[model samples]
Target chain A: MPGDVNLWPKLTGGEVIDLLASLHGRLDRARKAELLERFDLDPTKRTRTCSKGNRHKVALVAALAGDVELLVLDEPTSGLDPLMELTFQQCITEAASGIANLVVTPPTLEELFVHHYDGAPARAGAASTSGGAR
Target chain B: MTTLTRSRESGPHAAPSSSTALTGTRRLLRFGLRRDRVRIPAWALSIGGLIAYFGAAIPAVYPDAAAMQTRAEIVRDPSGAFMTGPGYGLDDYTPGVMIANEVLGMIAVAVALMSILLVVRHTRAEEEAGRVDLVRAGAVGRRAPLTAALVLLLVANLAIAAVLLAAVLLAALLVNDLALPDSAAIAAGAAVVGLVLGSLAAVTAQLSEHARTASGTAGGLLGLAYVLRGVGDAAQPGGSTLSWMSPIGWAQQTRAFVDLRWWPLLVGVGVAALLLTASFGLVGHRDVGAGLLPARRGRPAASRDCSAPRV
Candidate 1:
């Protein structure tokens, strides 16, 4: 990557991850491997061919790898699944514990205030007076 | 040493505040090259191959001085001159100059197109795709993408020049008195035109948010340059300064084998430098993915369109 600027239209998952690591300017080999393994990303697949979840992971890994003071993330986990979202949050938490200065937008109420798994809206006040309606 | 290790080992990553914005230019360039691996080779091979063919074919067509004179006369007619621009070295009727006369104009246009496409693809296209901001988020300078694009273009042009030289030289039997100097000049003229148009696109890339519009704008300028020079070459009594008005005109004045004048090349190089500098300034001051000329809002109310089906 000493020369070409990859908009990375065709770069594979591994290549993209490596580029992210390089851009961060540290731990080239080890960090790329670790990020890919940690995210469960397939190294051989091109970014375009990746699923939305994989794409989100790519960005997440890239952000985590950058050697920057401030990271302004806007819905960084927009398209990810719950499991990957958890992993992303864990990674960010770990990454933030030491160096990065994060100015993150809090998670939307739709994600945090609503839990669809129980088939009920997670409202603190409505829980006790819940009524069955058609 | 202690601090370096601490920064490296202490966190996910570390940023030394003093590191320059252009820290990742080389990476961007290499990535760009990978993306263009196929397109660049295809363009270069076809153009180079055709130039080689022209170098061989033109001399064969005019084996004798008499034949060369007849061809020269044909090229002089205003209609005939329009396409090729007032045939330089027609009076001398030498094969080397004739090779140039027939090829340089078309080659100049091709070179210009190649440059325009490259700049737009690397700069505006990337911005349009929203990938530019992703790269910019890192240690890249505001001008690094543009710089990388131009630098890559230089390599592409050099490759073209090399391929052209090889092609011409291989066909170099001095058949119609084709000489090394003439062939090299033809290649140089083509190469110089490429640099001119490359810089033109660099400037244009900053003018439009949409890649299509940027490409169109650059293409339009190339068309204008060609027309201005073509008309000037044909209409002027004898090599008018009208040709001086456009970049292509400056290139043609190199006169390849006939005069081998190198001074006109300065015009193109100087203009290209100025344009490149302006582009860097424009990019540095403006927001990514937004052009200097902001897009205008459409009509607030929509007109009924009963005639067309909506998608």
Candidate 2:
């Protein structure tokens, strides 16, 4: 079950191991291992109901391991720590090298450049009205 | 150790092997079952209970064969027959047959609804939530999840059938006077109808883009089936030929407790299989999160009609 206990019993452990092995290149196994070790999660314990961050980690690891041509990530780093968030961006940038990476997010990340449109008519009206009054 | 280093090291990797898709389907089905455990069982129980309740109530309402005849006469009338079914003028009109005439269509509708909800929840709902993209990026194929969902629906339908059979038998035994074969036949007839509608829903779920649309399509078909069955049964009292067109008609034609034609059940099974195969064929052709007929795209920006100023 590739550490996901919720996977169906019909799928054998060998099949999951094969999938993980294929995705090995995209994700850093050492980092995932480190997180698991730091959290003191049993290697044998399957992930039943994980938190949002944990689910993100699982998804990120899975995504990295495969040849995902287009990673349509929607608010992928919303719930991550600063360090993890930085790591996520780096991973995304790296993954984007040979593929099209489309990441959609709200206007909250400071790292993203914003382009606000100024209303020309409103500005012109204000200037003309002020000048006429003066 | 970092993601940057990993990406730098492993750029432009090969796709996973084909086997990963099968594994993904299994995983998805397991997850679906876990999510819908409570919902599916509740639906099955409610349908089974309704069947059992009707089975027990009918005999008490019309105790003797003469009373059963009077009730059949009312049902045999053009209006009553059109609304319900052809009043099979069995000399000994048993309560089991009476209940079958009254409730089989309703139970079939319930089964159809459950099938629609289950299929759509697994397919379109997952796609809308963006889960399909994640799963698709893996070894999963476009059709595997849909296949798994259909299989799950099949299992659920079979479970409902078994429960209905058990409930009907229990009701007959409790009532004391009703014959056992008659009760079994009635339950079997209803189960056959439920199976057909359930398979129909499975097929419809794959054809429509959204869950609601899929449900509406399946519900419309079910309603049509019932109306056709009622009309055909009413128009030709004892003839079974016209009844074959409608799944509900096929079920009622079983005439459990009266004549007990067990063979008509095979027609229901055949139709269910045909629909299930059609669903599979549709799944094979369509992309994940998409239907044979794609969802129409709306205007990119909000329309003036949507954001209009108040009067």
Candidate 3:
């Protein structure tokens, strides 16, 4: 989900949601309706006539309605009101609770240091040495 | 509402399995068309209306041979040649010839503009607005958007052609009898011009991340072509090298009612095909929401007037 969701201005909020969900290979109508109600978005209204917060809600409903394994939201609440923000928090928390087998694997120290360090020392004339080292 | 979970033929991440660049093109086409329902009709009708009006009105304005000859003389002047075409069929000056020579250029310009706007609106404009990022996040393929845009261009241009053909046929029956092949050529010429420019706009869309820049580049090219056509026709009898250089000129050289040539239109088709190939190749080289052309970098530091307390 993008921070500022840009949609087809000519399409109603409902149509946009359906279009996105359909593209993702599914359309859970019940889930979509619930999300629309929770977000308080009028699905009949075209996106061009929507306010910034309303547009964000339209994207929110579409993303939430999808049955994806991961939901990556960037600044999801930037445009929402306080009440809507609370609703968003509740929804995300509830959804996260549904993940039963979450796992984490740590990278090896050598691998981590080699790939993650951005400020590593820049050594000169190491091009020929790297082949020998490997 | 009843819950309906309709699974597509493939899974969510079906793009890899299919190994096709144009997956989800049909859906995108439907979506694009729905979005432009009002826009397509408006453009089609206006251009078609102009053709119909001119086709019918021109004959009425010059009903007889003498009147048409006089009108043809005026059209043969330097100003007319510059604004119109190579002054085809001026000796005979029939209604069909008048419309083809004088009105086709103006109609072609409108069609080209329509094509450019349609392609840009779906491709670059959507990408610039961040809408494309969201769309691509789905099961949609990389080339689906561009394909959809081009398809929409085809649909819109076809609509114009249908209207144009009907108008020509109607005008022939009621106002002036025109050659069937000439009418068909006129319709074909206009639609082909639209396709040529639309494809050019598609290539331009890939060159820039900004919608305005992409549309502007395509429009600037169109303007240049129109100017070249004007200058080339004005200076020469059958059009000089400058006219041949433009897509607009290629369409005009069809000489629909006068000479009724079909070979000139092939130039537009070949150019459009080459441009389409280039644009599709460009898409794979760039990331979503990024352009082939590099964007200008901003200043590293703010000026003294941009202090935090200034707020």
Residue by residue across A1-134, what tens digits does model 2's lDDT show?
11121232233322332244353334445755644443333334233444555555555555554545544344566556777766766666555665534333422435443312122212212322112311
Runs in model 3 lying further than 4 Å from the true structure: A97-134, B1-16, B297-311
- Say which prediction, candidate 1 or candidate 2, comes out ahead on DockQ: 1
Q: Give the winner by TM-score.
A: 1
Question: Which candidate gets the maximum lDDT versus the true structure?
Answer: 3
Cα lDDT, model 2, residue B44: 80
Ranking by lDDT: 3, 1, 2
What TM-score does candidate 1 get on C-alpha atoms? Answer: 0.85
Residue B35, model 2, lDDT: 66
Residue B106, candidate 3: C-alpha displacement in angstroms: 0.7
lDDT of 1 by residue, B1-311 (tens): 00000112344544477666466789889988887888888887888787667657765776678997998898888766767765777788776666667677787889889989998999999888877767776777777888889999898888888777766665555454557776776677788889988988888889888988998998998899888877887885234766678787877787776767788878888888888888888886667778888787787766667446587
Q: Give the TM-score of candidate 2.
A: 0.71
Cα lDDT listed for each candidate: 0.72, 0.62, 0.78
As a whole number from 0 to 100, the lDDT of residue A112 in candidate 1 is 36
